[model samples]
Target: MTVANRFLSIDLEKCQGCLSCMMACSLAHEGESNLSRSRIQVFQNPFGRVPDDLKIHYCMQCEEPACMEACPAGVIYADTEKGNVKRIHTEECIGCMACITACPYSAMIWDLENQHPLKCDLCADTPYWNQDRPACVEICPMKAIEVRSEE
Candidate 1:
């Protein structure tokens, strides 16, 4: 089968509120502990009844990402090789809040101490391909996620 650049998409229909994705996301991104540092967040709808309320939230990595355009520091860049991967050049960032504010999905967050933005790179810098999928996709006990090319 031919492969295309893509990300692991979580099926909200199957998520059980286990938060394994959040844990994995934090571990991979921060290289340390702290839930606030995690790029992916799970929220339960206060108004929804029972199971439908729970869902995992993260970047959709939109076809045209606002975060990339909003960064005044020019830290965010689309991966020329993979297209699907977006990267932030940490060294170039000036800790400006433009990108975080531009993200409609709230996928971006401020890294206070570092004074930089912290968000999901979808584990792109890691050795995820040789393994199964990203750590979040692999560790999801409910098997609620899958990686695929755009249709």
Candidate 2:
């Protein structure tokens, strides 16, 4: 069956860099508020002249994902039912760090403790807190992030 592909769309202009999304993401995935483990990250543009130069970074879930191709262990695969969302099977991951190097956007985050790389999976296609949305999108106070579905 064909399923609509979902992607997280960010409005940079609306982002306040409060990092509420990152905190929420860590809480949901790690059962604690640890930004280091968050799949989503916020970076401040150091060379920018303006103080509001911040960027929210996360997986794009590309049509052709480099991470999936770079995984020698075949841990990363696309979820066809969830609109081809790219996901990493942690159990099968070999922690080769290939996905981290292959990502052009540097969206993949390394887990120092687990020795595995992490990326956004749109909350693993599960309902968060009874809501059918990602924790980051739901907790954003500025509403800077949104999930868009492509048919």
Candidate 3:
């Protein structure tokens, strides 16, 4: 699987799992500080090594998005205007979870409240954080996550 260079990259060694990135993501996109609403996540693995102990989940902005291909309702589309960010048309989604299941990086998250899948859109239309990059990148305390050079 040769994916194009992703919009976001991570350095595991720098992450401490404080979850500031997740909080910022949720606040920016969902307007609340709820971990469940966050598009990016940090999972702690007790059995892993120092850096490998933390796992970050975020949209890669794939050139060929698996989520888009797996959508039965054809609601997931790429926003060419915003660096081809993969987004879901919530109104048209069928809540089938195919996109969530097909995502290679597990980037598509289930919106428990909306009954739909959610993927990172780089805060293209967010009202909370009026920044050039995604909120997560800016809020990362350890600077573990960063916008990829190609973007």
RMSD of each: 2.9, 2.2, 3.5
Better of 2 and 3 by TM-score: 2
Query: Tens-digit lDDT track for model 1 on 1-151?
Result: 4324565577778887777777887787667656777777888887885468976657776778899999887888866555366678988898778988898888777878777887766677765533247768877898987665563
Candidate order (lDDT)? 2, 3, 1
RMSD in Å for candidate 2, one decimal? 2.2
Q: Give the higher-TM-score candidate: 1 or 2.
A: 2
User: Which lDDT tens digits does candidate 3 get at residues 64-114?
Assistant: 788889888999887666666677889999999999999999887898999
Candidate 2, position 76, lDDT = 91
**Local distance difference test, candidate 2:** 0.84
Tens-place lDDT per residue, model 2, 1-151, is: 5567778898888887788999999888888899999999998877773336886679998878898898899999888766677899987888889999999888999989888888998887445733247999999998888888777
- Order the candidates by TM-score, highest first: 2, 3, 1
TM-score of 1: 0.83
Model 2 scores a TM of 0.90
Range of the 10 consecutive residues with the lowest summed lDDT in candidate 2: 124-133
Best by lDDT: 2
lDDT of the candidates, in the order given: 0.73, 0.84, 0.80
* lDDT score of residue 66 within candidate 3: 87
